[model samples]
Target: MDGEYEIKKAYASILESDFERAIEWFERAVRLDPDNAAYHYKLSVTYARSNKLGKAIEHARTAANLHPDNESYSYHAGTLEAKQLLQDAEKYIDGHTQPHLAVDLLKQALLLDPLLIEAYLLLAVAYGELEEFGPALQAAKDAVKLDPQHVEANRLFEQYREKLKRYLRS
Candidate 1:
C-alpha cells in the first residue's frame, strides 16, 4: 500500500514537472519494493529527465540486472553506458595523448550500440591515426553503411579508399 502511494506521488510529481519530487518519491518506492524492477526503472527515467545521468545509469543498471530479460531496461542501460563511454573517448581524443585509449573506449561504445555511426566514424579516424589502415577503412565503411548520407563518414570513407590505393601502388 505504501509502495503504491509512493508510486502515485511519483507519477503526480512527474505530471507536475517536479522531477526532484518525483525522484524522491520514486526512491522511496524502490526502497519499499526493492525487488520491483519497474520501480527502479521509473526512478532511472526520472533521473534521466532531471539530467542526473550518473544516477540514471545506476538505477537503470539495477533494473536491468534485476530483470535481465527485460529488453527495454537493458537497452536503456546500454545506451546510458555508451553515452558515458563516448564522452570519455572524446576526452581522450581531445587530449591528443592517447589515441589508443580513445580507440578502446570507442570500441566498448560500439559494442554496446553497434549502429552508433558517430562511434564508428571516430573509431575509423583513430585507427587511421595509428596507421591500422585495414580496420580503419572497415570502420569507415561501416559508418557509411549505417548512414550513407552522413557527411563525415562519406568523407572518411573516400579518404581511406585513396589511402589504400596509394599504399597498394607504393
Candidate 2:
C-alpha cells in the first residue's frame, strides 16, 4: 500500500482508539515516508497515547522542526517539554523557582496554542504557587473560556478568584 494509505489507516485506527494497531501502522507509514512531518505528528500522538513519552517527544520534535508553523505539532512538543520540565522541577526545587519554570513552560505552550485549556490551567496553578494572584486569575479565566465544561478549569478559576480577592484585601 501507499504511504498515504498507510497513514490514513493509522489515523483510522487511532480514531477507533486502537492505539497499538495505530502505532504499528503509523510506524509502517513513517518507515515508508520518513520525511513526512504529518506522519511524524500522527506517530507522536499515538506514542503519547500509548505512554511512550520518549518516542512521543522524539517524533513530536521532528514534526515541529519539519513544520515550524504547524500549530498542532508545536503544541504537542511544548506539552511534552512542559511535562518533562514539571517533573524535573518537582524533583529539584525547594523554593519558588519550580513554579516559575512551570509558568514559563505553560506560557510557551499557550503561545503555541492559545486554546489549550490544560496549559491555561497549569499556568493558573503555577501563578498561584508564586502568589501572583492576578495572573493566576487571568489564566483560570482563560481556561474556563476555552473549555467552559472543564471541571478542573472551573474549580481552578473559582479558587484563583478567591485568592485574588484575598490578595486585593490584603
Candidate 3:
C-alpha cells in the first residue's frame, strides 16, 4: 500500500483510540516515505502520545533536521528535548544527594526552553540544595519572570534572597 493509504489508516486508527494500531500504520508510512518530514512528525506525535519519549524524540529530531525551516517541527523537537532533560533532572533531584547533576540538567533544559517555568523552579530547588543562594534566587526570579502569577516562584525568590542576604552579612 502507498504511504498516503498508510497515513489514512493511521488517522482512522487514532479516531478509534487504537494507538497501538495507529503506531503500526504510522511506522509503515514512515518506512514507505523515509524522507517525508510530515510523516516523521506524525510518527513522532504518535509515539509521544503512546508514552514512548525516546522514539518520539528520535523522530521529532529527524523531522526538524529534514525541514529546518519548519518552525513547528523544530519547536516540537526542542520541547520534547527539554521535557526529557527535565525528567532526568527530576530523577537526580529525587536522589537528594545529586543536586549538582540536577542543576546541570535543569540548566540545559532552560536553555532549550527558556519559557519553561517548571525548569526554572526546579533549578532554584537544586541550587538551594547546593546552598548556592545567589543562583537559587536568580533561578526563582527567572521563574517569576516567566509566570508573574506563580506563588511558588515568588516565595522561593523571597526565601533565596533572604538566604543570600544572611550569607553576605556573615
Candidate 4:
C-alpha cells in the first residue's frame, strides 16, 4: 500500500484505540516520510495514550521542532512534560520540597497554552499546597475564566476566594 494509505490506516487504528497497531503503522509512515510532522504528532499522541511518556515527549518535541508555529504540537509537548512533572511531584508530596517544582512545570504548561483547564486547576492545587494563597487564587480564577463549566475550577476558585478574603480581613 501507499504511504498515505498506511498513514490513514494508522489514524484509523488510533481512532479505534488500537495503539499498538497505530504505533506500528505510524512508525512505518514516519520511516517512509520522516519530514511529515503530522505523522510524528499522531505518533506522539498514540505513545502518550499508551503510557509511553518518554517516546511521546520525544515525538512531540520532534513535531514541534519541525513545525515551530504549530500550537497543537507545542501544547502536546507541554502537556506531556506537565504529566511527567506531576508524576514526580506526587512521588515527593510527603517531602515538602518538590511541590514548588511541580508548580513550576504546571505554570510552564499554562504558559504554553492558557486554555489548558486541567493544568490551571493542577497549578492552583500545587500553589495551594505550597501555601501560596494569592497565586492559587489567581490560578483558580484563570481556570474558571477559561472553563466556566469546569466543576473543579469553579470549586477551587470559590474556595480560594473565601480563603483569601478571610486572610485579608485578618
Candidate 5:
C-alpha cells in the first residue's frame, strides 16, 4: 500500500510464486522509496525470474550503480545481460545462426563473474559456431579451469582441443 507493507506483500507474493503480483507490489515499493537500492535490487531479481531481461538488467545495473560495492547486483546484472546476448546469438535467419554478439556479451559476463563456468562454455560454443577455433579452444579451457568436472564444459574442452590440433596441423 504505502511503504513497508508493500515490501512485505512483494516478498510474500514472491514466496508464493505469484511473480506478477510480486512485480506490482515491488513497483509500488520502488515508487514509495525511489532511492532505495534494496528495493531496486529486489525488483531486478523479480524481473529476471519473470524472464523480463531488459527490466531486470536496468534495475540491477541501477542498484549496482547506486551501491557499487555490492558485487551481487553487478554479478546478477551481468548474468542477465549474458543470457540476453546468448538468446540473441541463438536466433536464426532463413538458414543461418548469428552468434557474433555472444562473444562480447560473454566477455562482459566473465568480467562480472570470472567464475561463471557456463558463460565460458557458451562462449566456446558461440566461437565454434563462428569457426573461430582458436578462441573457442581458449574459452573451453577457461571453462575447464573453472569446473574441471562439468560435463558439458569438459566435453567442449575435449572437442575444441582436438579441433585446435587439427587446425594447427592442417
Candidate 6:
C-alpha cells in the first residue's frame, strides 16, 4: 500500500482511539517513507497517546531533525524529551533511593522545559533529601517564581526556607 494510504488509515485509527492500530499503520507509513517528517510526527503523536514515551521521543526527534524549520516539530521533540526526563526523576524520587540521581534528572528536565514547575518542586525535594537546604530553598523559590499562585510551591518554599535558616544557625 502507498504511504499516503497508510497515513490515512493511521488517522482513522487515531480518530477511533485505537492507538494500537494507529501505531501499526503509522509505523508502516514511516517504513515506506522514512524521510517523511509528517509521517514521523504523526507516528510520534500516536506513540505518545499510547503511553510509549520512548518510542514517541524517538520519532519526534527524527521528525524534528528531518524538518528543522518546523518549530512545532522541534518544540514537540523537546517537550517529549523533558517529560521523559521528568518521569525518570520521579521514579527515583518516589523510590527515595537516589536523590542525587533525581536531582540531576530534574535539572536536565528543567533545562529542556524551564516552565515545568513540577521539576523545580521535585528538585527542591531531592535537595532536601541530600541535606542541601540552601539549594532546596532555591529550587522551591524557583518553583514559586514560575507560578506565584501555586499553593504547593509556596508551601514548599516556606518549608525549605525555614530549613535553610535553621541549617545556617546551626
List per-candidate RMSD values in Å: 2.4, 4.0, 1.8, 2.9, 2.7, 1.9
Evaluate all candidate structures by whole-model CA lDDT and list the values in order.
0.89, 0.82, 0.94, 0.82, 0.82, 0.92
Cα lDDT tens digits for candidate 2, 1-170? 44888888887997898989999999998899888999999899889889888899899999999999998898889787666554544432335557888787667666656666767777788888889989999999998888899999999999999988988898
lDDT of 1 at 138: 94
Give one digit per residue, the lDDT tens place, for model 1 in 1-170.
Answer: 54899999999998998989999999999999998999999999889888788999999999999999999999999887887788788887777778899899999998898877888988888888887777889999999999989899999998988888888788
TM-score (all chains, Cα) for each model: 0.82, 0.68, 0.89, 0.78, 0.82, 0.88
Per-prediction tally of clashes? 0, 0, 0, 0, 0, 0
lDDT of 6 by residue, 1-170 (tens): 45999998988988898889999999999999999999999999888988899999999999999999999999899888988999999989899999999999998988888988989999999999999998999999999998999998999899999988898898
Question: Model 4, which residues run further than 4 Å from truth?
Answer: 69-79, 82-97
Error of 2 at 12 (Å): 8.0
Error of 4 at 144 (Å): 1.1
Give the Å shift of residue 76 in candidate 6.
Answer: 1.6
Give the candidates in order of lDDT, highest first.
3, 6, 1, 4, 5, 2
For candidate 3, the per-residue lDDT at 65 reads 95
Q: Poorest 10 consecutive residues of model 5 by lDDT?
A: 89-98
Report the lDDT tens digits of candidate 5 across residue range 44-130.
Answer: 999999989899989998888888888887777777777766555445211245567667767776776687777788889888888
Candidate 1 lDDT score at position 87: 79
